[model samples]
Target: MTDNPAPAVVEPIPKWHEFMVPVLRVLSDGKPRTRRDSLTATLDEAGMTEEQRAVMLSSGQPKAENRIGWAMSDLTRAIAVAKPERGSFVITDLGKDLLQKNPYAITQEILRNIPAYRDYEPQRQNVSKADPVDIAVEDSELDPTEQIERGIQLLRADLATDLLKRLQERHPDFFEEAVVKLLLTMGYGGAENRGRRIGGSGDGGVDGVIDQDALGLDQIYIQAKRYAPDITVGREAFQSFVGALAGRGATRGVFITTSRFSAGAIEYAKSIPTRIILINGKQLTELMIRHGVGVQIAKTYTVAEIDEDFFE
Candidate 1:
Protein backbone atom coordinates (compact mmCIF):
# COMPACT_ATOMS: atom_id res chain seq x y z
CA MET A 1 0.00 0.00 0.00
CA THR A 2 1.14 3.56 -0.79
CA ASP A 3 2.02 5.73 2.23
CA ASN A 4 -0.28 8.66 2.99
CA PRO A 5 1.19 12.07 2.07
CA ALA A 6 1.90 14.66 4.77
CA PRO A 7 -0.73 17.32 5.23
CA ALA A 8 -0.17 20.60 3.41
CA VAL A 9 0.55 23.46 5.80
CA VAL A 10 -1.60 26.58 5.60
CA GLU A 11 -0.04 29.93 6.54
CA PRO A 12 -1.63 31.76 9.44
CA ILE A 13 -3.40 35.07 8.89
CA PRO A 14 -1.66 38.25 10.11
CA LYS A 15 -3.74 40.28 12.51
CA TRP A 16 -3.11 44.02 12.67
CA HIS A 17 -4.51 44.04 16.21
CA GLU A 18 -1.91 41.54 17.40
CA PHE A 19 0.90 43.67 15.98
CA MET A 20 -0.33 47.01 17.32
CA VAL A 21 -1.32 45.52 20.69
CA PRO A 22 2.29 44.72 21.50
CA VAL A 23 3.53 47.96 20.00
CA LEU A 24 1.15 49.97 22.17
CA ARG A 25 2.02 47.91 25.22
CA VAL A 26 5.71 48.62 24.70
CA LEU A 27 5.04 52.33 24.39
CA SER A 28 2.75 52.43 27.42
CA ASP A 29 5.47 50.85 29.55
CA GLY A 30 7.83 53.68 28.69
CA LYS A 31 7.65 57.43 28.02
CA PRO A 32 8.88 57.78 24.40
CA ARG A 33 11.22 55.50 22.47
CA THR A 34 12.79 54.82 19.10
CA ARG A 35 11.39 52.15 16.77
CA ARG A 36 14.41 49.95 17.26
CA ASP A 37 14.16 50.09 21.04
CA SER A 38 10.42 49.75 21.08
CA LEU A 39 10.33 46.90 18.56
CA THR A 40 13.16 45.02 20.21
CA ALA A 41 11.67 45.41 23.64
CA THR A 42 8.23 44.43 22.45
CA LEU A 43 9.57 41.28 20.84
CA ASP A 44 11.61 40.35 23.90
CA GLU A 45 8.73 40.90 26.27
CA ALA A 46 6.30 39.04 24.07
CA GLY A 47 8.77 36.14 23.63
CA MET A 48 8.51 36.35 19.87
CA THR A 49 11.13 35.78 17.18
CA GLU A 50 12.32 38.39 14.72
CA GLU A 51 10.35 36.67 11.97
CA GLN A 52 7.20 36.60 14.09
CA ARG A 53 7.74 40.25 14.94
CA ALA A 54 8.14 41.04 11.27
CA VAL A 55 4.83 39.31 10.55
CA MET A 56 3.06 41.06 13.40
CA LEU A 57 4.47 44.40 12.35
CA SER A 58 4.01 43.97 8.59
CA SER A 59 1.38 41.26 7.89
CA GLY A 60 3.89 38.33 7.73
CA GLN A 61 5.92 39.27 4.63
CA PRO A 62 9.33 40.83 4.05
CA LYS A 63 7.49 43.91 2.77
CA ALA A 64 7.00 44.96 6.36
CA GLU A 65 9.32 47.94 6.12
CA ASN A 66 7.40 49.49 3.25
CA ARG A 67 4.04 48.85 4.92
CA ILE A 68 5.31 50.26 8.20
CA GLY A 69 6.71 53.28 6.41
CA TRP A 70 3.31 54.02 4.88
CA ALA A 71 1.65 53.53 8.26
CA MET A 72 4.13 55.90 9.85
CA SER A 73 3.18 58.56 7.35
CA ASP A 74 -0.48 58.20 8.24
CA LEU A 75 0.25 58.18 11.97
CA THR A 76 2.53 61.18 11.65
CA ARG A 77 -0.15 63.13 9.85
CA ALA A 78 -2.55 62.17 12.62
CA ILE A 79 -0.09 63.49 15.26
CA ALA A 80 0.03 60.06 16.92
CA VAL A 81 3.71 59.72 16.07
CA ALA A 82 6.53 62.15 15.45
CA LYS A 83 10.06 61.93 14.13
CA PRO A 84 12.19 64.37 16.09
CA GLU A 85 15.38 63.48 14.22
CA ARG A 86 16.57 61.59 11.20
CA GLY A 87 16.22 57.82 11.57
CA SER A 88 14.50 58.16 14.91
CA PHE A 89 10.75 57.87 15.54
CA VAL A 90 8.81 58.22 18.76
CA ILE A 91 5.26 58.26 20.04
CA THR A 92 3.74 61.71 20.53
CA ASP A 93 1.56 63.05 23.39
CA LEU A 94 -1.47 62.02 21.41
CA GLY A 95 0.00 58.57 20.92
CA LYS A 96 0.57 58.23 24.65
CA ASP A 97 -3.01 59.31 25.28
CA LEU A 98 -4.27 56.71 22.86
CA LEU A 99 -2.00 54.04 24.29
CA GLN A 100 -3.72 54.41 27.67
CA LYS A 101 -6.93 53.07 26.17
CA ASN A 102 -7.86 49.64 24.72
CA PRO A 103 -5.43 48.57 21.99
CA TYR A 104 -8.33 47.76 19.62
CA ALA A 105 -9.37 51.40 19.70
CA ILE A 106 -6.05 52.69 18.35
CA THR A 107 -6.94 52.95 14.66
CA GLN A 108 -10.30 54.68 15.06
CA GLU A 109 -9.38 56.72 18.13
CA ILE A 110 -6.23 58.01 16.50
CA LEU A 111 -8.09 59.01 13.37
CA ARG A 112 -10.83 60.68 15.41
CA ASN A 113 -8.28 62.95 17.09
CA ILE A 114 -7.00 64.43 13.85
CA PRO A 115 -9.04 67.07 12.05
CA ALA A 116 -7.65 66.20 8.61
CA TYR A 117 -8.33 62.53 9.23
CA ARG A 118 -11.85 63.29 10.36
CA ASP A 119 -12.51 65.28 7.18
CA TYR A 120 -11.24 62.45 4.96
CA GLU A 121 -12.17 59.57 7.25
CA PRO A 122 -15.37 58.54 5.51
CA GLN A 123 -13.76 58.17 2.09
CA ARG A 124 -10.63 56.53 3.41
CA GLN A 125 -12.57 54.18 5.67
CA ASN A 126 -14.82 53.20 2.79
CA VAL A 127 -11.84 52.22 0.68
CA SER A 128 -10.18 50.21 3.43
CA LYS A 129 -13.45 48.51 4.35
CA ALA A 130 -14.49 47.76 0.80
CA ASP A 131 -11.17 46.72 -0.73
CA PRO A 132 -10.90 43.21 0.77
CA VAL A 133 -14.52 42.28 -0.04
CA ASP A 134 -14.24 43.75 -3.53
CA ILE A 135 -10.98 41.93 -4.16
CA ALA A 136 -12.43 38.63 -2.91
CA VAL A 137 -15.53 38.99 -5.09
CA GLU A 138 -13.51 39.99 -8.11
CA ASP A 139 -11.12 37.10 -7.67
CA SER A 140 -14.05 34.71 -7.54
CA GLU A 141 -15.79 36.25 -10.59
CA LEU A 142 -12.86 36.95 -12.95
CA ASP A 143 -10.56 34.57 -14.75
CA PRO A 144 -7.13 34.14 -13.20
CA THR A 145 -5.47 35.25 -16.45
CA GLU A 146 -7.45 38.50 -16.50
CA GLN A 147 -6.49 39.24 -12.90
CA ILE A 148 -2.83 38.56 -13.67
CA GLU A 149 -2.90 40.92 -16.66
CA ARG A 150 -4.52 43.69 -14.61
CA GLY A 151 -1.95 43.21 -11.84
CA ILE A 152 0.87 43.47 -14.39
CA GLN A 153 -0.49 46.72 -15.79
CA LEU A 154 -0.82 48.21 -12.32
CA LEU A 155 2.73 47.20 -11.44
CA ARG A 156 4.10 48.68 -14.68
CA ALA A 157 2.35 52.00 -14.14
CA ASP A 158 3.52 52.18 -10.52
CA LEU A 159 7.08 51.32 -11.52
CA ALA A 160 7.05 54.00 -14.23
CA THR A 161 5.80 56.68 -11.85
CA ASP A 162 8.35 55.68 -9.19
CA LEU A 163 11.22 55.71 -11.70
CA LEU A 164 10.23 59.15 -12.97
CA LYS A 165 10.06 60.53 -9.42
CA ARG A 166 13.46 59.04 -8.56
CA LEU A 167 15.02 60.44 -11.75
CA GLN A 168 13.69 63.87 -10.91
CA GLU A 169 15.04 63.55 -7.36
CA ARG A 170 18.43 61.79 -7.66
CA HIS A 171 19.64 61.87 -11.27
CA PRO A 172 18.16 64.67 -13.36
CA ASP A 173 21.01 64.56 -15.93
CA PHE A 174 20.47 60.83 -16.45
CA PHE A 175 16.92 61.60 -17.58
CA GLU A 176 18.27 63.50 -20.60
CA GLU A 177 20.80 60.74 -21.33
CA ALA A 178 17.96 58.21 -21.05
CA VAL A 179 15.89 59.97 -23.73
CA VAL A 180 18.87 59.93 -26.11
CA LYS A 181 19.69 56.31 -25.32
CA LEU A 182 16.06 55.27 -25.82
CA LEU A 183 16.09 56.96 -29.22
CA LEU A 184 19.33 55.20 -30.12
CA THR A 185 17.90 51.92 -28.86
CA MET A 186 14.99 52.39 -31.29
CA GLY A 187 17.45 52.55 -34.26
CA TYR A 188 17.86 56.29 -34.60
CA GLY A 189 20.93 57.55 -36.54
CA GLY A 190 22.87 59.57 -33.94
CA ALA A 191 24.86 56.74 -32.29
CA GLU A 192 28.04 57.34 -34.35
CA ASN A 193 30.91 59.55 -33.10
CA ARG A 194 29.12 60.00 -29.75
CA GLY A 195 26.33 62.01 -31.43
CA ARG A 196 28.68 64.88 -32.43
CA ARG A 197 29.93 66.77 -35.53
CA ILE A 198 26.85 65.83 -37.60
CA GLY A 199 24.24 68.55 -37.83
CA GLY A 200 25.30 72.18 -38.20
CA SER A 201 23.35 75.45 -37.75
CA GLY A 202 20.69 76.19 -40.45
CA ASP A 203 20.33 72.40 -41.04
CA GLY A 204 16.62 73.00 -40.38
CA GLY A 205 15.42 71.70 -36.96
CA VAL A 206 17.90 68.81 -36.85
CA ASP A 207 19.90 69.06 -33.63
CA GLY A 208 21.64 65.68 -34.06
CA VAL A 209 22.23 63.52 -37.12
CA ILE A 210 22.77 59.77 -37.11
CA ASP A 211 23.98 57.86 -40.14
CA GLN A 212 21.65 55.08 -41.28
CA ASP A 213 24.59 52.74 -41.91
CA ALA A 214 28.18 52.20 -40.86
CA LEU A 215 29.61 53.69 -44.11
CA GLY A 216 28.51 57.30 -43.19
CA LEU A 217 26.17 57.47 -46.23
CA ASP A 218 22.47 58.09 -45.33
CA GLN A 219 21.37 60.01 -42.24
CA ILE A 220 18.29 60.59 -40.06
CA TYR A 221 17.69 63.82 -38.13
CA ILE A 222 16.92 63.96 -34.38
CA GLN A 223 15.36 66.62 -32.13
CA ALA A 224 15.48 66.05 -28.36
CA LYS A 225 13.52 68.03 -25.80
CA ARG A 226 14.01 67.91 -22.01
CA TYR A 227 10.69 69.21 -20.82
CA ALA A 228 9.10 69.60 -17.42
CA PRO A 229 5.51 69.60 -16.27
CA ASP A 230 3.13 72.07 -18.00
CA ILE A 231 5.59 72.27 -20.91
CA THR A 232 4.00 70.52 -23.89
CA VAL A 233 5.34 70.41 -27.47
CA GLY A 234 2.95 72.24 -29.78
CA ARG A 235 2.14 72.08 -33.51
CA GLU A 236 4.24 75.16 -34.26
CA ALA A 237 7.27 73.50 -32.66
CA PHE A 238 6.64 70.29 -34.64
CA GLN A 239 6.24 72.35 -37.85
CA SER A 240 9.54 74.14 -37.25
CA PHE A 241 11.25 70.82 -36.49
CA VAL A 242 9.88 69.29 -39.73
CA GLY A 243 11.01 72.34 -41.70
CA ALA A 244 14.55 71.73 -40.50
CA LEU A 245 14.42 68.01 -41.40
CA ALA A 246 13.09 68.83 -44.91
CA GLY A 247 15.87 71.40 -45.35
CA ARG A 248 18.40 68.61 -44.68
CA GLY A 249 16.68 66.42 -47.34
CA ALA A 250 15.85 63.85 -44.68
CA THR A 251 12.50 62.08 -44.86
CA ARG A 252 12.70 60.58 -41.37
CA GLY A 253 13.05 62.51 -38.10
CA VAL A 254 12.63 61.48 -34.45
CA PHE A 255 11.18 64.05 -32.05
CA ILE A 256 11.84 62.92 -28.50
CA THR A 257 10.57 64.99 -25.58
CA THR A 258 10.43 64.42 -21.85
CA SER A 259 6.97 66.03 -21.96
CA ARG A 260 3.82 65.16 -23.88
CA PHE A 261 2.92 66.46 -27.35
CA SER A 262 -0.27 68.43 -27.81
CA ALA A 263 -3.08 66.78 -29.81
CA GLY A 264 -2.61 69.17 -32.73
CA ALA A 265 1.13 68.45 -32.78
CA ILE A 266 0.51 64.68 -32.92
CA GLU A 267 -2.04 65.09 -35.71
CA TYR A 268 0.28 67.41 -37.65
CA ALA A 269 3.21 65.01 -37.36
CA LYS A 270 1.08 62.11 -38.64
CA SER A 271 -0.02 64.16 -41.65
CA ILE A 272 3.59 64.70 -42.81
CA PRO A 273 5.96 62.26 -44.60
CA THR A 274 8.81 63.23 -42.26
CA ARG A 275 8.08 60.01 -40.32
CA ILE A 276 8.13 61.84 -37.02
CA ILE A 277 8.05 59.55 -33.97
CA LEU A 278 7.04 61.27 -30.75
CA ILE A 279 8.02 59.90 -27.32
CA ASN A 280 5.92 61.61 -24.71
CA GLY A 281 7.05 62.12 -21.10
CA LYS A 282 4.89 59.33 -19.71
CA GLN A 283 6.00 56.83 -22.33
CA LEU A 284 9.61 57.88 -21.96
CA THR A 285 9.54 57.37 -18.21
CA GLU A 286 7.90 53.97 -18.60
CA LEU A 287 10.52 52.87 -21.12
CA MET A 288 13.39 54.07 -18.96
CA ILE A 289 12.03 52.31 -15.88
CA ARG A 290 11.33 49.08 -17.80
CA HIS A 291 14.85 49.00 -19.31
CA GLY A 292 16.54 49.80 -15.94
CA VAL A 293 18.26 52.81 -17.48
CA GLY A 294 18.94 54.71 -14.24
CA VAL A 295 16.87 52.92 -11.63
CA GLN A 296 17.43 49.96 -9.30
CA ILE A 297 15.00 47.67 -7.56
CA ALA A 298 15.27 47.92 -3.80
CA LYS A 299 13.13 44.85 -3.26
CA THR A 300 11.96 41.92 -5.34
CA TYR A 301 8.98 39.59 -5.27
CA THR A 302 9.06 36.06 -6.62
CA VAL A 303 5.69 34.59 -7.57
CA ALA A 304 5.60 30.82 -8.02
CA GLU A 305 3.43 28.66 -10.25
CA ILE A 306 1.76 25.58 -8.86
CA ASP A 307 2.87 22.13 -9.95
CA GLU A 308 -0.33 20.30 -10.88
CA ASP A 309 1.48 17.03 -11.66
CA PHE A 310 2.39 16.65 -7.96
CA PHE A 311 -1.31 16.48 -7.05
CA GLU A 312 -1.92 13.72 -9.56
Candidate 2:
Protein backbone atom coordinates (compact mmCIF):
# COMPACT_ATOMS: atom_id res chain seq x y z
CA MET A 1 0.00 0.00 0.00
CA THR A 2 1.23 3.47 -0.84
CA ASP A 3 1.33 6.11 1.83
CA ASN A 4 -0.76 9.23 1.23
CA PRO A 5 1.06 12.53 1.15
CA ALA A 6 0.46 15.00 3.97
CA PRO A 7 -2.30 17.49 3.45
CA ALA A 8 -1.27 21.05 2.64
CA VAL A 9 -0.96 22.98 5.89
CA VAL A 10 -2.12 26.32 4.55
CA GLU A 11 -4.98 27.06 2.18
CA PRO A 12 -6.44 30.30 0.93
CA ILE A 13 -9.27 31.62 3.10
CA PRO A 14 -12.22 33.52 1.69
CA LYS A 15 -11.65 37.22 1.07
CA TRP A 16 -13.42 39.79 3.31
CA HIS A 17 -15.99 40.72 0.64
CA GLU A 18 -16.82 37.05 -0.02
CA PHE A 19 -17.98 36.67 3.59
CA MET A 20 -20.71 39.35 3.31
CA VAL A 21 -23.41 37.02 2.08
CA PRO A 22 -22.47 34.24 4.47
CA VAL A 23 -22.60 36.58 7.48
CA LEU A 24 -25.99 37.89 6.33
CA ARG A 25 -27.31 34.37 5.90
CA VAL A 26 -26.27 33.45 9.45
CA LEU A 27 -28.41 36.31 10.84
CA SER A 28 -31.28 36.02 8.34
CA ASP A 29 -33.57 34.55 11.02
CA GLY A 30 -33.42 37.98 12.73
CA LYS A 31 -32.29 36.40 16.00
CA PRO A 32 -29.57 38.42 17.72
CA ARG A 33 -26.27 36.61 18.21
CA THR A 34 -23.02 37.56 19.84
CA ARG A 35 -20.22 38.33 17.44
CA ARG A 36 -18.31 35.23 18.56
CA ASP A 37 -21.33 32.93 18.08
CA SER A 38 -22.19 34.53 14.74
CA LEU A 39 -18.69 34.08 13.45
CA THR A 40 -18.62 30.44 14.55
CA ALA A 41 -21.97 29.75 12.88
CA THR A 42 -20.81 31.46 9.70
CA LEU A 43 -17.65 29.39 9.72
CA ASP A 44 -19.64 26.17 9.93
CA GLU A 45 -22.14 27.31 7.32
CA ALA A 46 -19.34 28.17 4.89
CA GLY A 47 -18.07 24.54 5.05
CA MET A 48 -14.47 25.67 5.37
CA THR A 49 -11.83 22.96 5.68
CA GLU A 50 -9.71 22.73 8.85
CA GLU A 51 -6.66 24.12 7.11
CA GLN A 52 -8.54 27.13 5.79
CA ARG A 53 -9.97 27.96 9.21
CA ALA A 54 -6.56 27.48 10.82
CA VAL A 55 -4.78 30.01 8.61
CA MET A 56 -3.68 33.17 10.43
CA LEU A 57 -2.86 36.73 9.49
CA SER A 58 0.48 38.32 10.29
CA SER A 59 -1.22 39.89 13.31
CA GLY A 60 -1.83 36.36 14.68
CA GLN A 61 -5.63 36.45 14.39
CA PRO A 62 -7.23 33.69 12.34
CA LYS A 63 -7.53 34.87 8.73
CA ALA A 64 -11.11 33.65 8.37
CA GLU A 65 -12.16 35.40 11.58
CA ASN A 66 -10.61 38.72 10.55
CA ARG A 67 -12.27 38.64 7.12
CA ILE A 68 -15.62 37.72 8.61
CA GLY A 69 -15.33 40.58 11.10
CA TRP A 70 -14.57 43.01 8.26
CA ALA A 71 -17.58 41.71 6.34
CA MET A 72 -19.77 42.36 9.35
CA SER A 73 -18.30 45.86 9.62
CA ASP A 74 -19.13 46.57 5.98
CA LEU A 75 -22.65 45.23 6.46
CA THR A 76 -23.03 47.44 9.53
CA ARG A 77 -21.90 50.49 7.58
CA ALA A 78 -24.49 49.71 4.91
CA ILE A 79 -27.26 49.59 7.60
CA ALA A 80 -27.72 45.91 6.75
CA VAL A 81 -26.57 44.62 10.15
CA ALA A 82 -27.03 46.26 13.54
CA LYS A 83 -25.48 45.72 16.94
CA PRO A 84 -28.58 45.55 19.12
CA GLU A 85 -26.29 45.08 22.13
CA ARG A 86 -22.53 45.34 22.68
CA GLY A 87 -20.83 42.47 20.83
CA SER A 88 -24.25 41.17 19.69
CA PHE A 89 -25.50 41.56 16.13
CA VAL A 90 -28.87 41.16 14.43
CA ILE A 91 -30.05 41.63 10.87
CA THR A 92 -31.87 44.91 10.33
CA ASP A 93 -34.83 45.43 7.97
CA LEU A 94 -32.43 46.75 5.35
CA GLY A 95 -30.20 43.68 5.79
CA LYS A 96 -33.13 41.30 5.35
CA ASP A 97 -34.17 43.16 2.21
CA LEU A 98 -30.59 42.99 0.91
CA LEU A 99 -30.39 39.26 1.67
CA GLN A 100 -33.67 38.61 -0.09
CA LYS A 101 -32.36 40.36 -3.20
CA ASN A 102 -28.83 38.88 -3.06
CA PRO A 103 -29.41 35.37 -1.73
CA TYR A 104 -26.32 33.79 -3.17
CA ALA A 105 -23.84 36.66 -3.42
CA ILE A 106 -23.41 40.36 -2.68
CA THR A 107 -20.79 42.58 -4.26
CA GLN A 108 -19.20 45.74 -2.90
CA GLU A 109 -20.87 47.62 -5.75
CA ILE A 110 -24.26 46.77 -4.30
CA LEU A 111 -23.20 47.97 -0.85
CA ARG A 112 -21.73 51.22 -2.25
CA ASN A 113 -25.05 51.85 -3.99
CA ILE A 114 -26.62 52.22 -0.55
CA PRO A 115 -26.50 55.87 0.50
CA ALA A 116 -25.55 54.93 4.06
CA TYR A 117 -22.41 53.07 3.01
CA ARG A 118 -21.28 55.91 0.75
CA ASP A 119 -21.96 58.45 3.48
CA TYR A 120 -19.91 56.47 5.98
CA GLU A 121 -16.88 56.33 3.70
CA PRO A 122 -14.15 58.73 4.79
CA GLN A 123 -14.27 62.04 2.94
CA ARG A 124 -11.28 62.40 0.65
CA GLN A 125 -10.22 65.57 -1.21
CA ASN A 126 -8.87 63.70 -4.24
CA VAL A 127 -11.19 61.97 -6.67
CA SER A 128 -10.02 58.84 -8.46
CA LYS A 129 -10.17 58.83 -12.24
CA ALA A 130 -11.11 55.14 -12.36
CA ASP A 131 -14.69 54.08 -12.99
CA PRO A 132 -16.68 53.38 -9.82
CA VAL A 133 -17.65 49.93 -11.02
CA ASP A 134 -14.03 48.91 -11.70
CA ILE A 135 -12.87 50.43 -8.43
CA ALA A 136 -15.58 48.66 -6.48
CA VAL A 137 -14.66 45.30 -7.99
CA GLU A 138 -10.95 45.91 -7.43
CA ASP A 139 -11.33 47.02 -3.81
CA SER A 140 -13.82 44.34 -2.81
CA GLU A 141 -11.31 41.51 -2.53
CA LEU A 142 -9.50 42.89 0.54
CA ASP A 143 -11.01 44.54 3.62
CA PRO A 144 -10.06 48.15 4.35
CA THR A 145 -7.29 47.21 6.80
CA GLU A 146 -5.91 44.69 4.34
CA GLN A 147 -6.20 47.21 1.53
CA ILE A 148 -4.03 49.64 3.49
CA GLU A 149 -1.49 46.93 4.36
CA ARG A 150 -1.37 45.72 0.75
CA GLY A 151 -0.85 49.26 -0.51
CA ILE A 152 2.06 49.72 1.89
CA GLN A 153 3.50 46.35 0.89
CA LEU A 154 3.41 47.29 -2.77
CA LEU A 155 5.05 50.65 -2.09
CA ARG A 156 7.79 49.03 -0.01
CA ALA A 157 8.42 46.44 -2.72
CA ASP A 158 8.83 49.14 -5.35
CA LEU A 159 11.10 51.14 -3.04
CA ALA A 160 13.20 48.05 -2.38
CA THR A 161 13.60 47.43 -6.09
CA ASP A 162 14.72 51.02 -6.60
CA LEU A 163 17.02 50.88 -3.57
CA LEU A 164 18.72 47.71 -4.77
CA LYS A 165 19.24 49.15 -8.23
CA ARG A 166 20.76 52.30 -6.77
CA LEU A 167 23.03 50.26 -4.49
CA GLN A 168 24.28 48.19 -7.42
CA GLU A 169 25.07 51.36 -9.36
CA ARG A 170 27.30 52.75 -6.59
CA HIS A 171 30.97 51.98 -5.98
CA PRO A 172 31.76 48.72 -4.13
CA ASP A 173 33.23 50.77 -1.27
CA PHE A 174 29.94 52.61 -0.87
CA PHE A 175 27.99 49.36 -0.31
CA GLU A 176 30.52 48.23 2.27
CA GLU A 177 30.05 51.49 4.15
CA ALA A 178 26.28 51.30 3.89
CA VAL A 179 26.17 47.85 5.46
CA VAL A 180 28.42 49.07 8.25
CA LYS A 181 26.08 51.98 8.90
CA LEU A 182 23.09 49.63 8.88
CA LEU A 183 24.74 47.48 11.54
CA LEU A 184 25.54 50.52 13.63
CA THR A 185 21.95 51.71 13.35
CA MET A 186 20.85 48.24 14.44
CA GLY A 187 22.73 48.88 17.75
CA TYR A 188 25.73 46.73 17.04
CA GLY A 189 28.36 49.43 17.48
CA GLY A 190 27.39 50.30 21.09
CA ALA A 191 26.03 53.72 22.18
CA GLU A 192 28.80 55.62 20.38
CA ASN A 193 28.16 53.72 17.09
CA ARG A 194 31.83 53.03 16.42
CA GLY A 195 32.18 51.19 13.10
CA ARG A 196 33.79 51.74 9.71
CA ARG A 197 34.66 50.25 6.28
CA ILE A 198 38.03 48.54 5.93
CA GLY A 199 37.73 47.05 2.40
CA GLY A 200 40.71 48.52 0.66
CA SER A 201 43.88 46.74 -0.53
CA GLY A 202 45.85 44.47 1.90
CA ASP A 203 42.96 44.55 4.38
CA GLY A 204 41.49 41.31 5.73
CA GLY A 205 38.74 39.52 3.78
CA VAL A 206 36.10 41.13 6.04
CA ASP A 207 34.75 44.50 4.87
CA GLY A 208 33.60 45.99 8.19
CA VAL A 209 33.84 45.54 11.99
CA ILE A 210 31.78 46.77 14.92
CA ASP A 211 33.31 47.40 18.33
CA GLN A 212 30.66 46.47 20.88
CA ASP A 213 32.57 47.91 23.88
CA ALA A 214 35.36 50.30 24.85
CA LEU A 215 38.28 47.87 24.56
CA GLY A 216 36.85 46.00 21.55
CA LEU A 217 36.80 42.77 23.58
CA ASP A 218 33.52 42.00 21.72
CA GLN A 219 33.44 42.62 17.97
CA ILE A 220 31.31 41.67 14.96
CA TYR A 221 32.72 41.14 11.48
CA ILE A 222 30.69 42.03 8.39
CA GLN A 223 31.20 41.08 4.73
CA ALA A 224 29.31 43.13 2.17
CA LYS A 225 28.92 42.07 -1.48
CA ARG A 226 27.35 44.52 -3.96
CA TYR A 227 26.55 41.94 -6.61
CA ALA A 228 23.76 42.51 -9.12
CA PRO A 229 20.27 41.32 -8.18
CA ASP A 230 20.53 38.34 -10.49
CA ILE A 231 23.81 37.16 -9.04
CA THR A 232 23.94 34.53 -6.31
CA VAL A 233 26.60 34.46 -3.62
CA GLY A 234 27.71 30.84 -3.51
CA ARG A 235 29.29 28.59 -0.87
CA GLU A 236 32.83 29.57 -1.93
CA ALA A 237 32.12 33.15 -0.91
CA PHE A 238 30.89 31.95 2.50
CA GLN A 239 34.00 29.82 2.85
CA SER A 240 36.16 32.89 2.28
CA PHE A 241 34.19 34.82 4.90
CA VAL A 242 34.49 31.94 7.34
CA GLY A 243 38.24 31.77 6.78
CA ALA A 244 38.48 35.48 7.44
CA LEU A 245 36.58 35.08 10.71
CA ALA A 246 38.87 32.22 11.72
CA GLY A 247 41.91 34.31 10.86
CA ARG A 248 40.64 37.00 13.20
CA GLY A 249 39.80 34.38 15.86
CA ALA A 250 36.21 35.68 15.78
CA THR A 251 33.08 33.63 16.23
CA ARG A 252 30.32 35.88 14.83
CA GLY A 253 30.03 37.29 11.31
CA VAL A 254 27.38 38.83 9.11
CA PHE A 255 27.32 38.41 5.34
CA ILE A 256 25.28 41.08 3.60
CA THR A 257 24.80 41.09 -0.16
CA THR A 258 22.72 42.95 -2.71
CA SER A 259 21.93 39.54 -4.23
CA ARG A 260 20.70 36.13 -3.18
CA PHE A 261 22.69 33.29 -1.67
CA SER A 262 22.83 29.77 -3.06
CA ALA A 263 21.16 27.00 -1.07
CA GLY A 264 24.54 25.43 -0.47
CA ALA A 265 25.83 28.67 1.00
CA ILE A 266 22.87 28.90 3.38
CA GLU A 267 23.25 25.27 4.49
CA TYR A 268 26.98 25.76 4.91
CA ALA A 269 26.41 28.70 7.21
CA LYS A 270 23.88 26.72 9.23
CA SER A 271 26.20 23.71 9.70
CA ILE A 272 29.28 25.69 10.66
CA PRO A 273 30.46 26.05 14.27
CA THR A 274 31.06 29.79 13.98
CA ARG A 275 27.94 31.96 14.06
CA ILE A 276 27.07 33.42 10.64
CA ILE A 277 24.10 35.54 9.59
CA LEU A 278 23.18 35.84 5.94
CA ILE A 279 21.38 38.92 4.62
CA ASN A 280 20.37 38.73 0.95
CA GLY A 281 19.20 41.47 -1.39
CA LYS A 282 15.57 41.24 -0.31
CA GLN A 283 16.46 41.15 3.37
CA LEU A 284 19.10 43.86 3.01
CA THR A 285 16.62 46.21 1.41
CA GLU A 286 13.98 45.42 4.02
CA LEU A 287 16.49 46.13 6.81
CA MET A 288 17.43 49.38 5.14
CA ILE A 289 13.77 50.40 5.10
CA ARG A 290 13.14 49.33 8.69
CA HIS A 291 16.24 51.14 9.99
CA GLY A 292 15.45 54.29 7.98
CA VAL A 293 18.89 53.98 6.40
CA GLY A 294 18.18 55.16 2.85
CA VAL A 295 14.49 56.03 2.97
CA GLN A 296 12.28 58.66 4.62
CA ILE A 297 8.64 58.50 5.56
CA ALA A 298 6.50 60.63 3.29
CA LYS A 299 3.31 60.41 5.34
CA THR A 300 1.79 58.90 8.45
CA TYR A 301 -1.72 57.65 9.14
CA THR A 302 -3.34 56.92 12.46
CA VAL A 303 -6.26 54.52 12.54
CA ALA A 304 -8.51 55.34 15.50
CA GLU A 305 -11.44 53.45 16.95
CA ILE A 306 -14.07 54.00 19.64
CA ASP A 307 -12.70 53.66 23.17
CA GLU A 308 -15.49 51.95 25.10
CA ASP A 309 -13.76 52.58 28.45
CA PHE A 310 -14.55 56.29 28.39
CA PHE A 311 -18.29 55.58 28.32
CA GLU A 312 -18.08 53.65 31.58
TM-score of each: 0.50, 0.55
Q: Can you tell me which runs of candidate 1 are displaced by over 4 Å?
A: 1-152, 166-176, 187-204, 296-302, 305-312
Error of 1 at 195 (Å): 5.3
Give the top-scoring candidate (lDDT): 2
Model 1 over residues 29-96: C-alpha lDDT tens digits? Answer: 44667766755665564455455444443335443333334444445445466555544556766767
Show pairs that collide, candidate 1. Answer: 189-210, 190-210, 204-244, 205-244
TM for candidate 1 is 0.50
How far in Å is the alpha carbon of 152 misplaced in model 1? 4.2
- The list of candidate 2 runs beyond 4 A from truth reads 1-139, 307-312
Q: Which tens-of-lDDT digit does each residue in 1-312 have in candidate 2?
A: 999999777757877778999999999999999999999999987877878888887879989988898788778767699766567899999999998999888887788787555534432224452335344454577688868975676457556655766788789999999999999999898899988888988668999999988889888899999996447899999999999999999999899998789999999999999999999877888899999998999889899999999988
Cα error of candidate 2 at position 90, Å: 56
